[model samples]
Target: MWNGDGTVEIDGFRVYYSEVECVRRIFERHPETAVNVRPKNQLVKNAYMNNLLDLIDIACLAPQELTEEELRDAENTLLDLVGVDFELDWLKKKLDELCVKKTKMETRGDCMRELDRMIVEQRQVLLALEVELKNEENEAVSDSARLGFEDVV
Candidate 1:
């Protein structure tokens, strides 16, 4: 860091050092990036953090101040932002709609499962009907033969 600006030497060239560590801590709770690259990741991280601040409107809170659920919710939101590839505004909208997205996916999956069950039931019913028809035909033929044999006697 030089003159309060983050700078680093890369390939014999000096450049602005990106703070991907901050992003990892907020989203993954780690201190370093997995690959130690992606200079733009820091920008996304800063914007996401700022947006969270604006959304929550709380600057500082003691660890004991927030419940477990609240802490998890905040952490999940940041994690969600890290996965978003769009602009900051889009990220905000996505965060607000995250719960709905999951619900929709789950509901669709349930519908698909129900349809599959119905198909299996229909197939079983059709098979049973075919067997019943075959049994009735065999009984009719046997009744006719018995009648003929009785007439001959």
Candidate 2:
């Protein structure tokens, strides 16, 4: 089933079956995966994570169905996924918490100074990303202008 917001609400087992069937169909019809358009990395990552979670569920509920090797592989893959970097919002939230902690410290020791240095460095990185995004937008606008109205349409 699909929600109004364009998100699916399917069981993990159903997801695994559906994805397997889809892959089967694709392999049967078009083995070569050459295409002009490709899914975004984020979307691919979400699907991979979903499949991994489904595997974990199966391992929990029906351990004998999967081989020990498969279980070990899945566990290692999950750990690798878990080690991915935190999202921007989460990083910002943790940074704010660190700032509060540093402020609450009574003395300006090496720990407090290191926290301050890290906070400043992270702020600089954020600012640089913002500047890069603005630069990209400006470049797009200039590219469109150079292409002329007819080409844009």
Candidate 3:
């Protein structure tokens, strides 16, 4: 005969009986049997619960499951775990802004270097011109002195 819950066994007649009844009777007769049985069931339940919790955690962290609120909370928790402030778009935007500012700074630095080079070149040209002017003035003074000496002689 088959007992409820689909367990089958031979009925009374010194023959097989319902497996379910047999098990039930075994547990009843040996109450200590429950000590073993309960832990097994509890372990299985705990395993299932742990698996579900992991799935929920993954879904929440990755924005793959759960509601929007749950995702937000998970995101916040993840950011907190990594010691970062939670801002969905902040990282990307900050990187872009920094890149733009870096380019501008590089350009400005290049321009400043070019200006410095030009200033150095101008200083060299001015020094050359001053030397040439002094040479011309010396020649003029020497010519004037020679003329005066020739007149005196």
Whole-model Cα lDDT of every candidate shown, in order: 0.51, 0.49, 0.46
lDDT of 3: 0.46
Task: Give the CA lDDT, 0 to 100, for residue 125 in model 3.
Answer: 100
Q: Per-residue lDDT for 11-91 in model 3, tens only?
A: 121212323454455335444422422223433533432332333334423222244454345445434322322122433
- Local error of candidate 1 at residue 61 (angstroms): 30
Indicate which candidate wins on TM-score. Answer: 1
Residue 35 displacement (Å), model 2: 33
Model 2 C-alpha lDDT versus the unseen true structure: 0.49
Every candidate's CA RMSD: 12.6, 26.7, 22.5
Off by over 4 Å in 2: 1-41, 85-153
Candidate 1 weakest ten by summed lDDT: 29-38
Q: Compose the digit string of candidate 1's lDDT tens values, residues 62-151.
A: 433445465457656656555553223433444445444545666888999999999999999999999999999999888776556667
Q: By lDDT, who's the top model here?
A: 1
Q: Give the lowest summed-lDDT range of ten residues in model 2.
A: 85-94
* Pairs that collide, model 1: none
Q: What is the TM-score of each candidate against the true structure?
A: 0.40, 0.27, 0.37
